[model samples]
Target: MNRFAALEAFVRVAETQSFSEAARRLRSSKSAISRNVSALESELGARLLNRTTRSLNLTEAGRAYFERVSRILADLDDADRALGQLQASPRGRLQVSAPMSFGFLHLAPAMPEFLARFPEVDVDLSLNDRFVDVVDEGFDVALRIGALPDSSLMARRIAPIRRTLCASPDYFRRRGTPQTPEDLKAHECLRNSNVARTQEWRFVDENGKPSLVAVSGRVSANNGDALRIFALSGFGVASLPTFIVGADLRSGALVSALDRFVPQDLAMNAVYPHSRHLSPKVRAFVDFLVARFGKRYWDPDDGRP
Candidate 1:
């Protein structure tokens, strides 16, 4: 009495003009096929078939229903094939969410190569500093930095996010450099207001001893790029990820402070709602990111801040 099965049976019998032939094509008993078609006609309250021992023919209503149902069945088959192909290969639109700074500085620059390698994957990237609900927002994947909170989302670490407390050389000259985590209190610190504890900076010493320092700043921003710009202009010392300030540190535009103590390192993770039966596009993109940013690509070669 399944309606779709009945519809399918009716269409098959009408097309072949024989219940026996339709049953053979469908691998079902002829009686079952006849019963299904009869159920369909009874439900519709219409005589769909005119039958005799010599020949079988469709009524006018049967012709109209068959036309529409056959098209629907064909479309359903096409959709099934398309979904199967999509699962088999990394093809179709991939919706990705990422942070503004990392997306702009790294992810966007790497898109050309990713697209070249995965030509069938069309990427739609959204960059924002705010945390997005992957399931609710319909994102296929999202790039998250720092420690992740407890969640139902599945995550894979893509890279290590090492941070450094640094300022321009000119600023160090004017305000003096901080030699210890405590000295940060006396300096003009630039904070990222996006985090919950904006003023609290955590560090670990060479022996792995942790220290929490409460810092104040004249300026605070939600975006890392804006904070990096402020630090580059000698406005204040900013605690920033090496990814954003790595080149600047290497070029001596910014100088590190409290070298003996390392800022609590974070990890860049790619998060998705489900792990089991993950789509090829999400797997490919996450694997690409992991391979691209091996170990400490954003950090200096010598591993100095």
Candidate 2:
């Protein structure tokens, strides 16, 4: 005799005012319904129904309990429905993480159009070069460049980013271009703080041969944008991403050095948590990134999946 089941049977009989009708509505045998009601009355020590030969009626106490229990169950159902609605709609804040230079140059510019499309979504953006813990930081998605370390995070490739050693024409004019990897030792250089190996750079040629060159620099910065500025100001030769110095190479403001050496360009990615259910907002933003930034500008070099 489950107490809740007995209460439900009692409430059903009171509302319908007939044991046979309550049994039919509840899809249970009439005898089982009667047994549950009897158990409930025995526990309460009160006669809840006035069972007459011709008709059924509720005792005053039964009617009062029915009013309270029915409203409680109804409110619980209403709350569940409200939460279901919220889970399906895309009206909420979406937090995103990205590198500083790319956020300022590429991602920030696309945000206006993204907001114009999904006006209901509030975008919260954080920019940095350090790896972010998406779940701990409460970010919806993170835009990452270069190679990502092995992890459990779900990643979607968006574009390819290439790293190259570049020098301004003024600097090249003054010190001359270094045709061979070893010749870089003779020139002033700009370096990034996170270079995996000091004085060592790796490259994969067009034919897929691998080589490593030891490099040294006069100036080093933790941020790639700073290194780009240093290269532009002729401070030294900077090893930087193609996106930062791509236009400069085409415009002849900078020239690629030791073309025979540099890391292979890599696909950029938008990574997120893998879980049971993705909120509508996360789905919408990823689709927006694919639709907006899914140009061939991504895989410029050897095109492969």
Candidate 3:
């Protein structure tokens, strides 16, 4: 028995929870995959999987073994990728995760050029607003916006994410413009329900002091694009990222306020699992993003008051 092939078969079967699926992924017969996994289990004198007629579940030992074995496979793949980096081009499927709004407005548009540049690379892009576990989800890299928490994953800043307070001109006309952060309390504000403390908006005052405002609104949405739509339709004042509202602000569909108090700036980042040898596809994609948006090119100068 090929020990490495058996290990790969076991890992794939554990991940897919099906001999057939594992066989398909590994490009082998189901019998072959089952034989390899059975051989591995026999060698270790442990039943790695608890199989039922309709379902397959990992035994406790299997779970622990899967964790270690997956990492080992990843390291081996990284070693291969490191050697391949010396070649002229990167060739592989790059799985990337990005926020819905940014992926739609920015990243999606840039893909054509990237694909054109790297003919050998294939991209699998997942657009979601929720936080994704990069390693567990098996993503090559994830594009994240805003302040990142402490994590073991490696991150590279692709660009600065600037946010602003904005509303439709009609709304500002109907309701007087706010002169101070305290004034937000008197007006309806569009809140993002996805973020922590959805009603609390943070800002930096002119004197470089932090100011927290407890804002309220009749309408709240989990998505920034939804909030931007609400703000554009004269629903209320929405604190939104410039990337979402830059075009509208420039076109007079939305106008920024409170230019004196700077909104907290976040960063667009590419995060990947830390590996001794980074994959060339991940490296190239991150580099492409840094070169594309490093200068805040998407921001509009006249968006603010």
User: Which candidate number would show the highest TM-score if scored against the true structure?
Assistant: 3
Put down candidate 2 lDDT per residue, 57-94, tens digits, no spaces: 87788777766765555455456655574467666899
List candidate 3 segments past 4 Å from native. 38-61, 302-305
TM-score of 1: 0.71
Candidate 3 matches the true fold with a TM-score of 0.88
Off by over 4 Å in 2: 1-89, 205-207, 296-305
How close is every model to the real structure, measured as TM-score? 0.71, 0.66, 0.88
Clash pairs, model 1 backbone: none
Candidate 1 lDDT trough over 10 residues, lowest sum: 78-87
Residues 1-305, candidate 3: write the lDDT tens digits: 99999999999988778899999999999999989999999999999999999999899999999888988997888677666565647678999999999999999999999999999999999999999988667788999988888987999999888888899999999998888888999999999999998989887788889888999989999999999988989989998888899888789898889977856568899999888777777778999999998877667885432
Q: How accurate is candidate 2 locally (lDDT)?
A: 0.77
Give per-residue lDDT, candidate 1, residue 299: 78
Best by lDDT: 3
In candidate 1, position 33 carries an lDDT of 96
TM accuracy, model 2: 0.66
lDDT for each candidate structure: 0.86, 0.77, 0.88
Candidates' RMSD to native: 14.4, 17.7, 2.7
Number of the candidate with higher lDDT, 1 or 2: 1
